[model samples]
Target chain A: MGEILVKEKEIVAPGDVLASGMDYIPTDGAFRDGENIVSSLLGLVYIKGRLIKVLPLNGVYIPKKDDVVIGRVSDMTYSSWFVDVGYAYDAVLSLKDASSDYIERGADLTTYFNIDDFIIAKVLKVNKSMAIDLTMKGPGLRKITRGTVITITPQKVPRVVGKMGSMVSLIKENTGCQIVAGQNGRIWINGTVPDMERLAVKAIKFIEQNAHKSGLTEMVKTMLSKEAKK
Target chain B: MSYNKRFDGRKFTETRPMKAKTGVVKNAVGSAMFQIGKTRAIAAVYGPRELHPKHLQDPSSGRLRCHYNMMAFSGSGDRVRPGPSRRSKEISYVTELALSPVLDLSAFPKTVVDVFIELVQTDAGTRCAGICAASMALADAGLKMKDLVCAVSVGLVGGTPVVDLNYEEEAYEEGAVDIPIAMTPRDGKFSLLQLDGDLSKEDFEKALALAKDACQKIYEVQKNALKERYVEDKK
Candidate 1:
């Protein structure tokens, strides 16, 4: 709980008042009465005033052994299917990663992951060959059926998803939209309808706009409510 | 003037898409990767701890040393070989100067604050971008500072001042010259200065004004990148 001055959506300037704490301010904008004026971006708010691009501020989403990632089946082979994780190379979630599930030789593996079936799988291995092996046996790590997907910068995926899912949890509670967030910036929203999907995207943009500031929860709820009515 | 011209369409001022990343590496106190158009840099911050090479140490306060290096492969043509060149040395000292003004060095006595920057892609203004990235990396390391310092290269293209200088927009100017400046927009202090071509005192002042204004805008991106890093660390 922090004392916030400028309300969400408030237009701030280069010398405007931001906050009073060890909490750091983003580099630019604003004013304060007898206090060290911080930049307008010193804290978070809900306005896409003028932004160039999303900034990544965490450990890069590098594929590690045994990490779960939801990927879209992009290409298929006689024995393997390529999944796009928005990386330099599409990760190969092979049949080997799938439950030691028996399969006929040379059969259409696309049936397991037809062109565009969303899958939740774990990385069994990534060889020097840059081949990514995936498996599906863990909880919540299954095929995705129907939902609207939102793509952000893969580098910015962590910021949108938040820590331990706190940010996404906030979005879920506010919009009631079931979300399938991928580390690669592919966000699927099981919104009741397209409206919910659009709302989810708008809310995400809202989070991104003011993510540098404090008090994110209240701002998100308000954006969702207003968006829902719209 | 072509119909498909930009605001002025003089070129050079056309900033391409920008990209930035923070904490791209581990085992470092703080790190960031920044790109503007085609120019890109990865900066890592280490220290505010015991100084090495005791001779270069400052007794009363912490000293900030910056190394600005370009990857041999960063440049498009001949690979940029590692090791400090004249430009790299000059840029390093200038960047060190920029960080010094806003740093609360006395907060950490007899220590060294180091900024290691690698320009992975060189289009133009890599030093300025490196400054912004290193400053944020210092913040990402949670080092105490009075303010976050940002830098932008402003060039005169047909008499119009541009914010962030791009590739063809920087070098090979026809009637334009580029002036690179580092300023803490919040404090209104100029830290680093580098110039190319020619400009009257009037154009110089005008470019400075534009640089400060642009610094404010750039500060937002710098902050967002840092916040993106901070929030992740918090999580």
Candidate 2:
């Protein structure tokens, strides 16, 4: 029989022994070393049946296919626009995928998406060399304007989104703000009143900062309600 | 002449007091400051981002570059020159070698992870201190690492095996052999070993053992520093 050394949700550093024996399998941020399973990251421990995995607490934004992300236009070629999605490489937004409408060759691309413009784009493809291709034709994908942008740790994006987006909806309902959260950890918030936008941003940041804790939903709710009155 | 008591009145196998903290540099992706006795090293990790100088990009996996430097007034004796020297270049190369084994950069092709280590104070074992600080910073940056790296200077001070020889011990009249060592604690394997003086085979083996034991202690400090950073955020 295998022995599980760490409890569920326990924080572990790299090389920490997670389990000891062949009956235990390692996956994701955990790895097998001889007869013992070891953690390969500084993260929370998770176990499912005999399989062990670690969810990282911190990391840079790695681009993935089909992930919605917000990017800034850094440069433009004659046929495509280079969008920086907070990754090591800039994603390309080709003219054809730039929009549903037809664009002429050598068209003044600046008129459509100028440099420094922020746009919500979807990852179309990521090659072996990590070159990313982005599309702007998807639903809810458009150039963002008249909103303040904030960034948080990319690893905390799932927490900010919450279960079926309940957390985001809570913030929206309480603050009356239009918000878009990107998988790359950028959030766009716009509201009629500056104070409401600030509240939403505060809530998102709160979630990001306290993503590792349990009962976060209740904590966030209490915080939002208390702040809403003042 | 015989070496009886330590110059600092420490035990033969004792290292100086250590202090470590992560996320010290707010602008960096990850950063840490490590101090041992009078020696202090601060390390910052910048990327798994694109590698510039077009030709240096590796298509197969990412590369790691380390920069080790000492401040102008950090040295105990004289002012260090501002720019990179031959000695700094060598230490930088060794620091990279000391850290690369545990780091898994295969997922980031054509990119580079840069580690900059600055020695703010120096008594002895500056390179070893830098390696320890750099390792913690890399982990704080969320880089995939197999284990934390620990380092210390261990050697024969007048034929007595000691762990973490200070500057005065290195300059002992009876002569001292300063051997700086770095280890991957989980595996108990040496990643860095450099000797500055001569020692008998038996003495060298004893010193190596002392270094191994000292490294384990340093590992605990490094691990706690990383965990404590998150613990403090909860309050």
How far residue A34's Cα lies from its native spot in candidate 2, in Å, is 1.0
lDDT of 1 by residue, A75-178 (tens): 88777778876443577766776656788887666566788888877777766434467777667777788877766544456667777888888788766789
How far off is residue B197 in model 2, in Å? 0.5
What's candidate 2's DockQ score? Answer: 0.71
TM of each candidate vs. truth:
0.52, 0.97
Which tens-of-lDDT digit does each residue in B1-235 have in candidate 1? 3223434354533344556676786766678888877788899977655576778766667789999998988887787767988988988988888888766555454567788998888888888889988877776665545577878888676666666666665554356577888887666788888888887888788788878877877777776666554455443
Proportion of native contacts found in each model? 0.01, 0.56
Residue pairs clashing in model 2 are none
Candidate 2 - CAPRI tier?
medium
Going through the candidates in order, their DockQ values are 0.02, 0.71
